[model samples]
Structures are given as structure tokens and as C-alpha cells.
Target chain A: EAGVAQSPRYKIIEKRQSVAFWCNPISGHATLYWYQQILGQGPKLLIQFQNNGVVDDSQLPKDRFSAERLKGVDSTLKIQPAKLEDSAVYLCASSLVGGSEQYFGPGTRLTVT
Target chain B: QQPVQSPQAVILREGEDAVINCSSSKALYSVHWYRQKHGEAPVFLMILLKGGEQKGHEKISASFNEKKQQSSLYLTASQLSYSGTYFCGTEGAGSYQLTFGKGTKLSVIP
Candidate 1:
């Protein structure tokens, strides 16, 4: 079976610029998630979607970051006015159901200069 | 809240054994383990629920103690491929979100 898929394996943007990442989760998966992984740290949950509906996004910085999963299959995460601190890998994952084993994508390495 | 992992890093020769521990302050519903190589996404290792069950995958295994809110990952007769950062993610009761620990860096030298 195919695993989760993400676009632009790497990205670089200037500070204050906007950037967007895309993800297509495994077919038939019911839960999708977005995470930010910094160097030497574990992936931090940014948001979660359960069939196109948000399940949790408490850790997300609403002032600069936003994400949406349309049709419960494809999802996008956007960051506006990116900060240098936002330079990290953006990972997309999907699971058969909530609280189940997750499959992650290649991830987009975003570097804000 | 984020869980705490012990032994921030460990180096072992192939065929040796190693254990990584994770502890959470809040009541846990489940614990998930993953291994991530440099520049690669994390790969799911196993998941243990609130029943205090133990699960194994190949030479790697894990045990969850719901009462203590702690989990331990065991690698027996470790292989070179076991070199990676191990992360433990915890899920609280009635919550689907997973808060991951800082990770334990394990290096297996041949």
C-alpha cells in the first residue's frame, strides 16, 4: 500500500514571506495530522483533522499558521509572515483511525532565511 | 504536556541490548513509539494501550504501565539498522492528540 505523500521535499523562503505545504494521505485513512519537527526534537503536533473536520489545533499559532483538509483526503498547511523560528521540517501523517498507528510522509524541510 | 524520556542518548555495539524509558505526568490512554533516521520521517514502531499490555516487533519490544504512566522500549540483540532517534508519544484519556517526547538518540556501532 502506498504511504502518505507530500510535496516539495524542501523549501526556502525569506523571513516575512508566505509559504504553503501540501499533503495527500493514504487512501481510506480517516485521520490526518500536521507536525513541526525542529532539529534535535520530536515532531510537535500542529493540527489534526478527522475526515475534513478539525479534531485538535490547540498548539497551532493561529496568528501565522493555518491548515485545512478538503474532502478528507488532501490537506494543506500555510504559514504567513514566516519567522526564522519557523524553520523546521513539516511532516504530514495519517492513520486508519484516531489513536492508531500513523504513517508519515517524506516531509517538507522549510528554511526561512 | 510533553512526556519525559530518559537516557537522552545511548551508544551500543551490535548484538547488545538497550532500554529507553518514557514517563508522563498526566494519565495516559496510550503510548506510541517511532524511530526516525536523519532527514527522514518517523516510522511507527508500536502502540500500547491503557491495559498495561506489552507488544513486540522483531527484536524490538515495549511495555506500558498505565498505573505509572510510563513505557519502556527494549531492543534486544540490536542491529546496525537500529541506529536512530526514538520518540515516545503519549495520548491522554479521551484525547486523540499525541504529545511526543524530546526523543532518545540511539547509535549502534558494529
Candidate 2:
């Protein structure tokens, strides 16, 4: 079985520039999540979607960060004005409805210089 | 809030044993353990809920003290494959967000 999939495995952009990351969840999975993992730190939840609807995004930075799961299968996370601290790995994960064990993708390593 | 992980890092030879501890300030409902290698996403190891008590898989197991809001992961007869950074993700009563710790790096050498 295929695990979660993400595109643009690595990205490099200047600070203040905009960048976007894409994710394709595992087939039949109902929940998708985006997480930011800085160097030497664990991944932090950025957003979560349940069947095309947002279940949680309290930790997301509304001013610069946005994410959407339109068809409930594929999702995208965007950063309008990136920052130096935004240089980190962006991970996408999916799980069965209310399932605690999540399958993660390769992740997009964003480097904002 | 993020839980506190002790020792920050550990080093052991093959066939050795090590214990990693995680503690939270607030009451926890569940604790999830994951391991990540350099440049890779974290791999889920196990989850320990306050109610489930002690659980483990193979040589790796975890114990949770519900009253103390503490969890300890046990690694016995460590192997080179077990070398990685360990993180404890904690969940509260009714939140979806998982606040993860800084992580504890473990290196197993032969």
C-alpha cells in the first residue's frame, strides 16, 4: 500500500517570498495533517483537515500561512511571506478517521534565506 | 505546552539498554513516541494512553504514570537501527494538536 505522498521534496526561496507545498494523502484516508519540523525539533502541527473540512488549525499563523484540502484527498500549504525561521521540513500525514497512528510522507524541506 | 524530555541525548553500544523519560506539566491523556533520522520524517513507534497503562512492542516498550504525567520508553539490546532522535508527542483532554518535545538523540554503536 502506498503511504502519504508529497511533492517538491525540497524548496529554497528568499525570505519574504511566497512558497507553497503540496500533499497527497493515502487512499481512503479521511484525515490529513500538515506539520512544521524545524531543525533539532519535533514536528509541530500546522493544520488538520477531515474530509475536505478543517478540523483543527488553531496553531496556524493566519497572517502568512494557509492550507486547504479541497477534494479531501490532496492538500496544499502556502506561506505568503516566508521568514528566515521558516526554513524547516514540512511534513504531511494521513490517517483513518480518528486513527491515532498517522502515516507520514517524505516531507518538503523549505529553506528561506 | 511541550513536554520535557530528559538527557537530551544518549549513547550506547550494541546490546546495551537505555531509558528515555518524558514529563508534562499538565495532565496528559496520551503520549505518542516517534523516531526520526536525519533528513527524514518521524516514524511512529508506539502510543501509550493514561488508561492503557504499560505497553510495548518487541524490545521497545513504554510505561506511563498517569498520576505523575510522566512516560518512559525502554530500549533493550539496542541495535544500530535504533539510533535516532526520539520524540514524545502529548495529547490533552480534548485537543487534536500534539505538542511534541525537543527530542532525545540516541546513538547505538558497535
Point to the candidate with the largest TM-score.
Answer: 1
TM for every model, in the order presented, reads: 0.99, 0.97
Pairs with backbone N, CA or C atoms under 3 Å apart (clashes), candidate 1:
none
**Residue-wise C-alpha lDDT for candidate 1, range A1-113, written one tens digit per residue:** 99899999999999999999999999999999999999999999999999999999999999999999998999999999899999999999999999999999999999999
Tell me, by DockQ, which candidate is best.
1
Q: Report how closely model 1 matches the true complex, as a DockQ value.
A: 0.95
Q: What is the TM-score of chain B alone in each candidate?
A: 0.99, 0.97
Best by lDDT: 1
lDDT of 1 at B51: 98
DockQ of each: 0.95, 0.71
The residue-by-residue lDDT of candidate 2 on B1-110, one tens digit each, is: 88999879999999999999999999898898999987788899998887858889999999999899999999999999999999998989777558899999999999
lDDT of candidate 1 at residue B54, scale 0 to 100:
99
Can you write out model 2's per-residue Cα lDDT over A1-113, one digit (the tens) per residue?
A: 98888999999999999999999998999989999998888889999898999989998999999999987889999999999999999999988864387788999999999
